[model samples]
Target: MSLRAVSMGAAYHTAGRVPGPFYRLAPVVAWTVWNLNPAWRRRLTRTMLPLCEGDRARARRAARRALQHVLEYYLDLVTLPRRDMSRFERDHLEIFHNERLDLLRSNGPVLLVSAHTGNAEMAIQALTFRGRSFVALVERLEPRDWAEYMLRLRSSAGGTFLEANFAGVRSCIEALRRGGVVGVMGDRDIQHTGVCTSFFGRRVRLPRGPWELARRTGATVIPIFSSRKRGDQFRVYVEEPFVVEESEDAERDIRAAVERYVVLLERHLRRDPGQWAVLEDFWKVHACGEG
Candidate 1:
């Protein structure tokens, strides 16, 4: 195994074996290191300022909180395998608009679209615990071994994991066609060939795969949001499902669907800007060329 993978594996094993309270210190250390790193601090500040409307102080505070939440999220991941389901449900997981989920459950297939906010991995696990079958579309990590490790974790959550590739795309379609749920992160476009849409009054490219899949399979697209409420606690919000409009022009339909997702994403971001953990220069990336 690669050195990074080996190290990660050891860390995960250690974290799992250790008691939960011992792992709580991890977020403090990680948050301190995050603040000490100039590059990371700059990235966080740059990403947060626009979201905070140019308030430097508010941006800095939000950035610090975001990093702390990220560390807590990672700590939860390591300890997740050993967590007791009853305790997990009672202490950590909170669901809102659950009736909406029930409504979708009775329908055909569902496309659960969410972003990189809160403990998203945990959110998926919570859904699986509720007896929802999911095929999660994931981006491969840098080291192959690390990707495999994450794949194992995701699979352990009682969901099928598919990398974001052509083969994965085929599997997603098959899963949806079989009346299964397919979860996708729709905020960022790793595949550069995404459809351009307006977000926070700025043009951004969001992954069009979810929209395309919904259109092709006639699946209902539901935007889900997960946000941290407190230490190791999260609230998951399930929005009403909507069908992507079908038209003669495929491209236009995809664009419309992507824009709709962006609108939902913006609404959630407005509610908790700090929870939107985007560390890149999102606003400036494709501002000039697309849309």
Candidate 2:
């Protein structure tokens, strides 16, 4: 058995057994320990420097908050399977501009590009509470059992979960072909293969799956995001939705759509960098080359 599997399983069970106050304070402790790690501090500071507008102290503060929120995200994710969907949605989740979600129910195929920011799972669960069912393309965690645990928990709310892979790509295309709603994480290039584009004024690679699926199926691509206001309070942002024009130049259309998605993501990050839950050094390659 992998160490990650043991740790994840233990955490899930322990988190469920702990008292509410200690469960709530777990993030503070987690982030405090995270900040004590020199490598983690560097990663957080590097990420926050630009997002915090170059204020070192402010960036550090934001970075700390961001780390805390990240731990909260994992905690919520693990314990979600035990939550009462209706009570959770009523007491914790708040959707801003929710009317925008109507696109998911329309006759046409819908593609939502999301980020690691905030509790995206919370947004997904809330949508399920409203009787909305969609396919969420999630990264497959290592140690197969861990991935299975994630899929089971996420799909417990009636939403579909597909691993981001070649087979998953086929499934996504099929879903869109049936005019289904599909969501993909737009910020991270998990597969390493991506479309190079400008984000935060620096060149970065973003996943090509969403744009490709949209182009092939003529699906409407919407740039949506979620942010943790505090505790269980979350905001799901639905911005401009557009279709990729199938012009003579396929690559151009995809790249242009990517640029638009990048703009929306940058706008969200600027509002509060701490909402971004990805703790890894995201920009492993930046400003390397033009698309």
In model 1, the number of clashes is 0
Mark the regions of model 1 whose C-alpha exceeds 4 Å error after superposition.
84-87, 284-291
TM-scores of all models?
Answer: 0.91, 0.91
lDDT of model 2, residue 34: 74
Prediction 2 TM-score vs. true: 0.91
lDDT of each: 0.78, 0.78
lDDT of 2 by residue, 1-291 (tens): 777667767877888555365457967696767757988888887778878778888877777888888777777766777777767666876766777877766788888888988887667666655555678888878779878877887787667888998888888888889888788888888887788887776677897778888999999987778898766677888787789889999889888888888888889999998888778776664333775
Over 1-291, each residue of candidate 1 has an lDDT whose tens digit, in order, gives 898678657767886668466446756775777867988787787778767888888887787777777766666666666776435655787888877777444647888889988877677766666656788898878788888887776666567887999999999999889888888999888877788776666676788888999999999888888998876789988887899988899999999888877878878876788897676767665453554
Clash-forming residue pairs, model 1: none
Pairs that clash in candidate 2 = none
